[model samples]
Target: MADENQGFMGAVWETIKTIFWALIIAGVFRTLFFQPFWIPSSSMKDTLLVGDFLFVNKMAYGYSYASCPNIKIARFGIDIDADDICGFLDGDNTRVLAGEPERGDVVVFRHPVTHQDYIKRLIGLPGDRVQVKEGLIYINDEPVKVEDGGTFTEVKEAQGPERRFPRCSNDPVGEGGQCVKERQIETLPNGVTHSTLNITDRGDLDTTKVFTVPEGEYFFMGDNRDNSTDSRVAQTSFGVGFVPYENLIGRADRIMFSSAGRSMLFFWTWRSDRFFKGIE
Candidate 1:
């Protein structure tokens, strides 16, 4: 009996040691190699939906301990190769000025006003003039095209209401204060093209002042346009003003997992459809 007791204790110690080592390895890999982030807003909508969990390639750019705790010589975040980058360290704690976020890449950055992490597609880069005329985005005096993904189909929420627009789709024309939306391809100065979404008759297209993506600063707008308060208006003055580069977090890579919000205390109510759908 005494021998048996001693053997059990030894086995337990070995198991604990194995678990401890595994945890250390996971922590290091998560911080230095790849990290995870979750979507919490509809700002990116069809591209990256809310409640989507994603794996960000930390080494896609680089990392410094400055962003993560328990280390010195901190790195703000990874510098992505694309305009929009993802894999945020901490939502509120990011610095963007060190690098240039590319055009058309969907990125996760710190909101200028709230300091909260927000993911938005890069429409204009530094030294470029950005304008939204009739929901069409024009950069450097050229029209950017948005790729069409077919009309969105959605089911109305209760009652005999109009058809519902799917997550990636926008309603046509403004009804219930929503504008008609479409997808088009955006072409950059280098002739590179990317997809974008727009809502007709929405947003303040004509502004008294022209916005130039300031040096060491970035201009951003929500894909939702009229529904989002971005760099268009002054942050303290009612809307998001000019965002500093320091507010940038990281670029979004891809969707790892997605699930619906079901708070019911049952197993069958879980969201199963969005489990592995890639972020488009």
Candidate 2:
């Protein structure tokens, strides 16, 4: 019986070690190669939709990775220990990260203010004048063409006992969370532009802050124009006022998968039509 017990213990230790090594290898591959991301918002509508699953190529832009970059905390190979001044992942320009961001590509970044994740198109490059005018988006005086219309509906239903229900409808106009509006776009003299609503004639963020698109910074804006709180909304436009190269998370490559409305239980609500759709 003692022999049997010893054998089982030996197998358990071997299995545990195997798992540890496998996880370490996988983490390294993902960090330096590709990382997966899930979409959670509609800020970039008519482009990337809600529920879209995607993969980001981390190496494309080059960012360093270490077990702990900014944490003074240490691990005992099994648990936590005491602390010290945190050391960052980069060892004084180790050159672990490399590459440049391009124009017109959809990118993900850490929100300068909230530090939350967001995705938008690259527009205003450094030193370029970025502005929105009378609901039209303009970059260097040229217009950013947007489709005439893009509207989606989100629906919710109530079950028995919990409810006096609101009316149910397939039409977007009557559906909750559904929005319908025309967006306008235009370009600026320096070539950076943004979007707006065609008839939101007088908006609070119409002008001012004639930024000279500082060097090493980039500008970003949502495709939904009137509905997005982007670079135009002064308070949240940091990093991209403009976006320094370091702040970029990754570029949107392609849609892996997406669910319509909100839930996946409703098979009919799936955007089967959009499956494998190419992203611009």
Off by over 4 Å in 2: 64-97, 145-178, 183-209, 235-241, 261-269
Over 221-247, each residue of candidate 1 has an lDDT whose tens digit, in order, gives 666554455676766744666665545
Candidates' lDDT values, in order?
Answer: 0.54, 0.56
Q: Which stretches of candidate 1 lie over 4 Å from their true place?
A: 1-27, 64-66, 69-100, 146-150, 157-181, 190-195, 204-208, 236-240, 263-280
Candidate 2 lowest-lDDT run of ten: 78-87
Q: Write the per-residue lDDT of candidate 2 for residues 167-189, one digit (tens) a residue.
A: 21222344244444454443434
Of the candidates shown, which would achieve the greatest TM-score relative to the real structure?
2
Best prediction by lDDT: 2
Q: What TM-score goes with each of the models?
A: 0.63, 0.69
How many clashing residue pairs appear in each of the predictions shown? 28, 19
